[model samples]
Target: MTVAVTGIGVACGLGHGKTAFRKGLYEAPDIFSCLTREGRGPAEGEPPFIGVEMPEPSEVLAPRLARTASFSGRVALSVLQEAWQDGGLDDIDPERIGLVVGGSNLMSREQALAARDYSARLAYVPPRHAHMFLDTDICGLCASTFKIRGFAYSLGAASASGAVALIQAREAIRSGRVDVCIALGALQDLSAYDLHAMRSLGAMGSMRFSEQPGQACRPMDAARDGFIYGEACAALVLCRQDLAAAGKTYGRIAGVGLAVDGARGPEPNSAGQVRAAMTALVEAGLSASDIDYVNGHATGTPAGDDAECETYRTLGLEEARINATKSILGHGLSAAGAIETAAVFIQMKEGLLHPTRNLEKPLDSRFNWVRSEPAVHDIRRALKLSFGFGGMDAALVLEAPDSGGHTS
Candidate 1:
């Protein structure tokens, strides 16, 4: 009961839709223009930083929804519309479709603000309906948007949420929970409070790249500074085999493997992540040689980069052409997996894979990290790896659609 992906929709700092995102991947690194508050940015002497910034939700979405939830809902609807147009669902009932969304932070930002205002002596919080913030509940937000009445649930696994959604969607459809399932993955920008808290703890990256907005996120390069934070919402529509027979199948989800590093704190076990990759490869009936490209989860952090490099070495997959997209789109937290998945799908369709940017020196000699140009390959199969905080790891095996014909 393998689930096949028929359509995909993504919104990120790069842009919306396939064309916009891909264009951002090839462009030179530039600083991102951030306007959370008017006239409030870097105080002179900030490092070059570019982010995949989305437009204000009030302009792009309905007025009633929260920013984060609206973005995720829009992505789901876009994918569903594309799936319907991809030549399927003519016979399927719209009521039977389902949704499983992954969200890490949910409405914590809004909730925490309200709680703080209530507790503060000088609390000046405006008279606003705090209940609008209630949909900050992950399940409530997603289910309401997609009208997924058959089945709906939310997953929270840090950056691994997207991969988790893929796994859950595959199983639910296989188990007869529903005929169609659209997996949504999303993350939002840090609330002002979150930023201040992270800065106090010395966890936030300094805005040192103010001179250059685009080149701020440099992964695998020797001059890499730190992770560039980003926000995004992405979704992939999947259906059972019979339903897909009526529609065009973009690709098939052959197998998925999840592993835990068991490493304490921020450090992840590189070896464990690699093991998960190998398991997915095996489960998909593929060999290391069969992998056309590796969509890496390198966040430009010192420890994360080191662990990922070590894993590549341990897996003996040094020959594989690797590309770290975080360098282009910034790290979208929970949405990173889904955004990268969408990027990989586009690369497969376009027959090209973009390289990591701003790399003057190679971090690992064994693996080729393309920085100058997109890698051209007959990508029949792709391996996407995501390793997140708390030692969570996930690997997915995606394959091109089967050719319509008899196999001797």
Candidate 2:
């Protein structure tokens, strides 16, 4: 029972499509400005900066859909189509294909709007507003849009959502429930309300890096204050190794591990996170030395950076080269895993590593974090780590196509 990744797609605040997102990854923008506050509110100057203003539905999708829903729909449909072609699914059974998605704010802006307007007296705003509350049900929305009649679930572990979704999708394929599993990760549009709430939690920031909107996301740098909250949608097509054997594979989803630390609100347990990474390595039947690079879930938080550094030292991966994707694409929350995974696929394909922005100072003494420029390294095996609220930690190992191994 092995699983291999055959197709990948990503859309984020960096741009509308995978190519755009990839370009944004390697280039550091001078600034990352905050978008409209459509969902919850963040304080005036908080750490979780918002990205991607409400894009017109027509730009990313057809008419008659909300912006958030449209982004999800567009990415899912595009990935499904691309994967079908990439995997050569002409002879495959549509029924044998399943969909699994992870989302933090399903239709957060919509839900917030509906909740705000749909009081006892103002219950008749419009059907659109009413639909927002329903949009929070990510599972139903994803299934309906994709016409997937097989196994489907919407997992919400806050920031860990994407990696967890991939883990679950791999399990489903390994269990023989389906021949193909698609894991989609997306987030809702942000609003001032969301910004204010984040500010209330002291999570927002006044990180006015520069006039350039792209340069603001600085990961692992000494001046890194907080994260720029961005919205994105990404999808991955996972199939059995036997299927991959019949054709070509972008990479292999080698192993997965998850753990819980019970840390404070919206923060991860560093110890638990380390254990998860170790478990993933062990499950893959490999050692820490097998991993060449790490896509860190460093959200520019004080506790998170220190915790991750401690975990790296504990796992004896202090010398492992690490970079933070959040600094590039903003914190896409649930979509971060899928987006980062796509980036991993790119690196595996191109044989080049994107450097972590910032990182003038080491958060910890042991780990070798990347700086402003890309690093040239031999990346045969890569680790993707994600931490969410309630101390939820997830780790996934990806092997380049020639690695001769797969994940399940």
Query: What are the Cα lDDT values of the candidates?
Result: 0.68, 0.71
Query: Number of the top candidate by TM-score?
Result: 2
* Candidate 1 local Cα displacement, residue 334, angstroms: 0.6
- Lowest summed lDDT over 10 consecutive residues: which window, candidate 2? 53-62
TM-scores for all candidates: the values are: 0.84, 0.87
Instruction: Write model 1 residue lDDT over 1-408, tens digit each, in one string.
Output: 767787777766666666677787766345255535322243366422335566533233365544444334444445444434443544567577777777656445555555666666545654443433432344555555545567777777777888888878887888888988877776554555555554444434455665665666777776565677776767787887667764467777777889887864556688789888988888777777777678888887766787888877776677777898887777777778887887777777777878677776767866867777777865577788887777888998888775221111
Report the lDDT of model 1 for residue 37.
34
Q: Which tens-of-lDDT digit does each residue in 216-316 have in candidate 2?
A: 55665556656667777778889988876454787888888999887768664777987899889998988987787888888876667767777777777
> How many Å off is the CA of 11 in candidate 1?
0.5
